[model samples]
Target: MTDPADGQAGSDGGHIDSFDDLDIAPRVRQAIADVGYESPSPIQAATIPPLMAGRDVVGLAQTGTGKTAAFAVPILSRIDPTARHPQALVLAPTRELALQVAEAFGRYSSHMPEVRVLPIYGGQSYGVQLAGLRRGAQVIVGTPGRVIDHLDKGTLDISQLDHLVLDEADEMLTMGFAEDVERILAETPDSKQVALFSATMPSAIRRLAQRYLHDPQEITVKAKTATAQNITQRYLQVSHQRKLDALTRFLEVETFDAMIVFVRTKSATEELAEKLRSRGFSAVAINGDMAQAQRERTINQLKNGQIDILVATDVAARGLDVDRISHVVNYDIPHDTESYVHRIGRTGRAGRSGNALLFVSPRERHLLRAIERATRSTLTEIGLPSVEDVNAQRVARFADSITENLGSDHLDTFRQLVENYARDKDVAMADIAAALALETRDGGFLMAPDPPEGERGERRERSPRRSSGGQFATYRIAVGRKHKVSPGAIVGAIANEGGLTRGDFGNISIRDDFSLVELPENLDNETLSSLRHTKIGRNPIDIKKDHGPPRTRGGAKRGGGHGRDGYGKRSDSWGKRSNPRVAGRGRG
Candidate 1:
C-alpha cells in the first residue's frame, strides 16, 4: 500500500485538491457533488488516500472537521455493493451517532442503488434490525452494545467484513464500551482494514491502537477552530460537593430562555434532571437508553417551550440543534476538549448570543487548561452566585409577580381578606400583607440569610478514615503478583469495566495471588459483576467487596492491614508497591 508523503495534510499540491482529485468510485464522486461538497476537508484529505490504499489509519481530529465524509467516502469507494453480508462495519458510541453515520453512508451511496446501509442501536426494535440484516446490507453502522447483541444472536454476520471503523473511539471507551468494542474487533476477519479515530489520544486509546491496529497512518488536525464570537464562555472552580448548589444558584441569577446541562453518565442525566425538577425547574433528561420516539418528544418539548432545561449526556445530545437554547451548562466536565466543544456548540446557533458555563472541580483544573489551550480562547473565571445574589434575584422576581397579579380579577378577594384581617386584629396593613406573603410561600422566606463568614458553599472532601462516608470502597480481585498483573493493567481493567474515570479509583495494592483496589463506594451490582469476570491476561478478576483484611492467597496476613503501607516502594511480587497516590482522589 502507498502512504502519503510525511503523513501530513496541507493545502499545497502534495494533497488532493478537491473531491475531483479523490480516486474514488464515480458514483460516490457524483453523490459528493450532489451533496454540494467541493474541497476535501483536512481530515478527509489526509485520511482518504491511505484508506483507499487499504491501509490502517488513526485519525486525530476534533469534531466538525468533516470526519464523517473522511471515512465514509473511502469506505463507500471500495465496498462490494453485491455482497450478501456486511462488507464494512462502523462502531459508534451512541445511537444518535450511529444513525448519523448510517445516514452519511446512505447519502454517499445514493447513486449505487445496490448498496444498502443499516443502523443498529439500542432503543430500536430488534425485529426491524433483523429484517434489515436478512435483506443483506453492505454497510452496517451500529453502537457497540446493540452490535454485540446481534453478533451474539447470530443474526449479524461480519465474518467477511473488509473495513472496520471505530468513530469517536475515545467516547466509546469513556462510556464503558471498551470490552464490547474489543470483542467486536476480535470477531472480525484478520485481514480487515481498521481505522481508529479520536479527538484526543489518551493512554487507554493509545494502548488500544497499539494492540489492535497495524502500522496505521496517523493524522492530526490542530484543534484551533474558532468558537462562536457571540458565545460567552466562563468556568467556575468549585469542589464536586458544591456543584449542585452552585448550579441552582446560577440558575436563579442568570436570565436564560432555555438551557442544556451536560453530564457524563446516563444515570447522572436522570438524577440531575430529577434534582432540577424538585428545585422547581421545568427539566428533563435524555440518553441513549430512551427510545427514539421518546427522545424526539423530549427534544420537541425543549423546542416548543414546554421544558426549559435538558440534562443530557454527550451521545444523547449529539447533533442536537435548538435555537432557543440560550445557555449550555457543563455540569460534569467532559473527558476531553472535543466533547467540551460539542457540548457548548448546542447553543450559540444562528449568530445568537449565548452563555456557556463549565463547572470545574479543583482536581479538574488541568482539563480546564487543556480546553483553553486547544480552543485558543481563555475562559473567564467566575464564582457561584452568593446568597445575596440569589436573594436579590428572588426579591426582584417576587415584585414582578406582584405586578403581574395586580390586574387579575381574583386579587380583589384576597385584598379584601387581608383588609378584613387587619381591621379585626388591629394589626398594621404592611404587617398583615407580610404575614399573607409568608403564608403563601412554601419555605416561608423572601430573602436568604448570609452564610457564616469564610464558609461559602463549598464542602470539604470526605475523611479517608470514614469507611463509607462518600469515600472509596476496598475490593479484592483474584489476580495479582502471581498472575503477573501490573498496577496499571489492573487500573485500566477496572476503569474500563466500570465505566469510570481516574477520579473514581483511589489506591491499588497488589499482594501475592490477590490484589486489593479502592474504588467508589457506590458502584452498582452490574458493574461489580462485569469487573468480576474481567480478565487481566488469562485469569478472571473474580472481584468481590473486601470486608475482611487484606490477605495472601494462602489466607495469611502479609503486613499491617493498612493498604498504603508500602506506599511508593517497589518490592518483590509478593510485596509489590501500591498505586502510591493519595487515598482520596489518587491524583498525586
Candidate 2:
C-alpha cells in the first residue's frame, strides 16, 4: 500500500522554524532529528513542502546546499519500505557520486530499517550487482552507463518506480551521457514524479527537463553567503588513525558548555559517540536514520546538560539551534565550503564569541584553503595536544573536583564508612583514601601513562625505507573505464584512505581490469590495512605490495580526468565541481 505520508504534500508554502512544521510522517520527522541538522537549508525550506505534496520540482540551485534531503525526505516518507522494488531512482554523472547518493538514501531509510537502497555502477561485478537487485531494493542510484547496463541485462525493472531524480543534469549532457539518460527515463512509467536539479541549466538540460518533468514548479535559490563573523576558526593536521585520540586530548584541555563533532557517515556518529561514552565523557549520536522520538529525546538531553557532546553528520545536524553550543569540531573536513560554513555556524550564534576547530589530514589541506577563501579569514594551524598537556589538564581538573567536594556535606556519609572499614581491617586512613581515589579515577584508566613521546610527535624517526622522492611501491586498483571510474575518484579515495598528500601520487595506469599507481614506498601498516578495506569503485583493490618494479598492463599510459569528448578536465572540475567544497546538493 502507498504510504499516507505522501498525502501530506498539500501542506505547502509555509514558513517553518523546525522540521516538525512540515506535514510528514512521524518516523521521517524522527529521522530528521537523528541527522542533527541545525535547520532547513534555504533550498530545502523552499522546495520540500511542495515536493511532499507530490508536485514535480524544477530546482535551480548550486550543490552543497542540502538539496539531497530536499527530495529524499518527501520521497522516503511516501515509499512503502516493505514492498521494495525500485520505487525511486536517482541518476548522477559519475559512478563515484552514485555511491554517495546511495549512501544518503541508506541513511535516510535507516529509520524504516527494512527499506533497501542499492548503488549500481559498471566497475562492480555483475554477480554482486545482481544479488542486490534480486533482494528488491526500493531505491537505486547509479551513473548513466551502469544504469543502462542494468536495464540491458534486464536486472532492473522501473515499472514500479514512482519517483525519478536527474541530479546534475547539465554535467550529464556535458559528459555526453544524455542519450543514456534519455533511455533510462523512457523506460520509467510516465506517471512518475520527476525532479531535475542542475547547478547551471544549459538549453540541453532544459529541453530534457521539459520533456521528462511534467508542469514542474520552478524553484530557484539565489546564491547567498551565510557566515558567522564571531567564529574563530582553527585547524589541526592529524593523520586519520590519530584523529580520535587527538579529539579526546583537545576535549580534556579545552573549555566548552556544549560541542558538536561532525563526521562524514551515519555509522561514524554512533561509533564516535560510543567511544566517547566509554571514556567517561557525556556524548550522544545524531544521524538521519534515527526515530523522531529518540532524536527528540537526544536533543532534550543536550538542552538539559545530560549530554555535552553531540556526534553528528551533515544532514542530521541541520537547523539545530542550541545556545549552549560553545564549540564545533569538524572531525571530518567538509567537502564543500557551504557545509563548512554551516558546520561552524552551529556555534557563535546571536553575537556570541564561539570558535570552531577543524581537523585536517595532510591530503585535505586544499579543503582548508577553500574554507579560508570562502570565509575570507585565515585559519590558524594548531598543533595536536601533547600527552603532557592532556595529563596536566586532567590533574588540574581532578584537583578542582576534590577541592569542591571538601566542604560538601555529601562527603560526611562516605567519611564515616571509610573510618569504620579502616578500623575493622586495621588499615591506615591514608590507605583507605587511596583505595577511594583509585576508584574515583575509573579504575585508573584516565590516569594511565600518556602515549609515548615518539608517538606524541616529539621526534622525527629516521626509517630505513622512508622515501624523500616519494618513489615508493606502485599499487593497482581494479576499476577503470569499464567501471565508469574517473582519475579524480581514484585520487580522492587513495589520498583519503591512505592519509597521504593528494599530490603525492606518481604515474597512474588505469586499465580495463586494473590500474597501476605509484605512491610513497614505505607506507605504515595502518595505512596499508586501510587501503586493503578501501573500495575504488565499491570494488576492493586487494592491495598487493608489488615486490617488483611497476609494470603496466597493455602498456596503457596513465590518463587525466576526461569524459567522452576527450577534453582534459581539471581534477577540481571532475563531477559537477571545479573544487571539492564547491559542488554538492545545494549552493552557498
Candidate 3:
C-alpha cells in the first residue's frame, strides 16, 4: 500500500498547485505566497511531504537548490506559537550560514505570530545568546561550538525538540567538528525527526548517517551539470594578498556593463567596496546586515549604471537576478563547490553570455578541484595584466571621453587655453597634446618595474625528489592520520592560518597521528613559531621536527593519537564535549 506521507496521488508528479494542495495550514500558504514562490523546487517537492508527515528525511542537494525552504516550510508549519521552547534546532558550520538559515526561517514564518528564531555562533557573547534563550525562541540556529556551549551551561533545553536538522553535514566534517556534532545529537531525544542535508556523501558523513539516522528516506537533487553554457569560466592562481592588485589590473583591461564581486565575509564586502570606490570605481557593498531599503537602492544603482561594481557576500546576493550584470568575480574562492556554482550563476542569466573570473589562492586549490569535479567544467587560467595592456586601455578610454566631451560647447575654453600654452612654450601642438594626455592618465605615468627573474611572482617551482636540493623544507605536524587530519585540511590551515601563500608550500603526506608539509626553506624561526601556534579545525599545532613517535612539548607521549574522534574530541569547560553533534536522529 502507498504511504499517505508519500503524497504521490496528485498525478502531476508531486507538483502542487498551492501550499493548500499539500495540506499545509493557511498561515503557511500565505507565507509561501508572500515569498512569491508559485511552485516548489524539485527538492522541496520531494522532501516537504514526508517532512510534514513527521518522517525523518536525508536530503542530498547542492547549494542554491532551494533546500532551505524544503525543510523550513514544513518545520514552520509545526511551530506551536504558545509553547515558546526550542522545538527546532538547525545546526550549520559557519556563523554566516547560521544567520542565513535563521533569516530564512524568519521569512517563511512571517505570518505565524509570536514565532521567534535565534542564531548562535562563537563570535557572539554568551550572555546575549542566553538572554535570547530565556526569552523563548521557538527555533534555534547555531554553529556546533556555540550550541554545545549553550547545551552544557543548562541554558538550552532541547527536550521539546520535535525537529533536528544538520545542514551541510559534509562541511561540519571538513571543519573537524564531527565529534561535537555527535555529542550534540546524543543530548537530543531519540524520537525527534532528523534531517541531514549535504552535497556529498563522503565516508565520514555516511558513517554519521548510519550511526545517527534511523531508516531515513534519502532524496538527492543533482547539481546543474553545466554552468550556464553562456558563461565563460576563467581563473587566476594568485596568492590572497595579491588578489586586490590582480582584480584592479583586470578591471583596467576589461570592460563590462556591470560587475558583481563575491567575497567571503560581510566585512570584506564593505572593505573591498570602499577600496574600489577610493580607487575611482562607482562601487558599493551589499550584505545581510543592510536594511531592505538600502539593499534595494544599491541594486537599483547597479541596474541604472550609477554603480558599476558591487562587492557582496553570498547571502545578500541570493535571489538577485540582474540583467545588467555582465561579469562575476570570485574575489574569494567559495567555501564549497556549490557556492562556486551559485556565485557564477549571478551572471549569465536570461540567455545572456557572461564572464566569470575566480581568484584562487594556492591553499584553495582543493576547492577548485572539487568545483571542477562537481560542475564537470574546465576553468581556463588567466594571466595577470601587463603594464602595456593597462596603458593601452587607459589611452583608449581617455580618447573616447575626449571625443564625447568635444560635442559640448564647454571644450572651447580648454581648447583656447591649450593653444595658448602651446604657443607660449614654443611647443608643437602635438607635443602639447601628448603632455596633457600623459598628465590626465590615472595610475601614474611610470609603471612599476617587473620583479627580477627568480622573483617574478610566479609560484616557486618544486622538484618531486624529497632531497634538500629543492627550495622546500619538509616539516612535521604532530597531528595526522590517527588524528583524522587530511592533507587538504593541512593545506587549508597553513595557507589561511600561517599567512603562507599557496605557492609557499609543496607536497604533503599524512602519517598515523601527524602530517608533514614542505614549506619554503627560508622560513624564519618566528614564522615557524607562528605556524606552531596555528590551529586547523580548532586544534593547536604542536609543529616540531618529524623525528618519530608523537610527543608532548616536553617530549613525553601525548596520549593516544589525539583521541579516537580525532580533532573533534576536545572537551569544553562548560561541562560538555566540544565535538560537533554526530549526524543523527536525536535532539540535543
TM-score of each: 0.74, 0.60, 0.74
Q: Write out the backbone clash pairs for model 1.
A: none
The alpha-carbon root-mean-square deviation between model 2 and the true structure, to one decimal in Å, is 9.6
- lDDT (0 to 1) per candidate: 0.76, 0.72, 0.73
lDDT of candidate 2 over 46-132, digit per residue (tens): 878888888899888665556777788888988887796899999876554566577667666778888888887644566887999
Query: What would you estimate as the lDDT of candidate 2?
Result: 0.72
lDDT minimum window of 10 residues, candidate 2 = 1-10
What ordering of candidates by lDDT runs from best to worst? Answer: 1, 3, 2
| Model 1 misplaced regions, further than 4 Å | 1-40, 49-64, 76-86, 89-159, 166-191, 196-220, 417-428, 444-471, 501-503, 550-558, 561-588
Tell me the tens digit of each residue's lDDT in model 3 across 245-356: 8988899899899999998667678899998987778889998789999999988888888888989887788778899999999988875566777778889988899999
Q: lDDT (0-100) at residue 424 of candidate 1?
A: 94
Best by lDDT: 1
Q: Report each candidate's C-alpha RMSD, comma-separated, in the order given.
A: 7.0, 9.6, 9.2
Native-to-model Cα distance after best TM-score fit, residue 382 in candidate 3, in Å? 3.7
Clashes within 3 Å, all models in order: 0, 35, 18
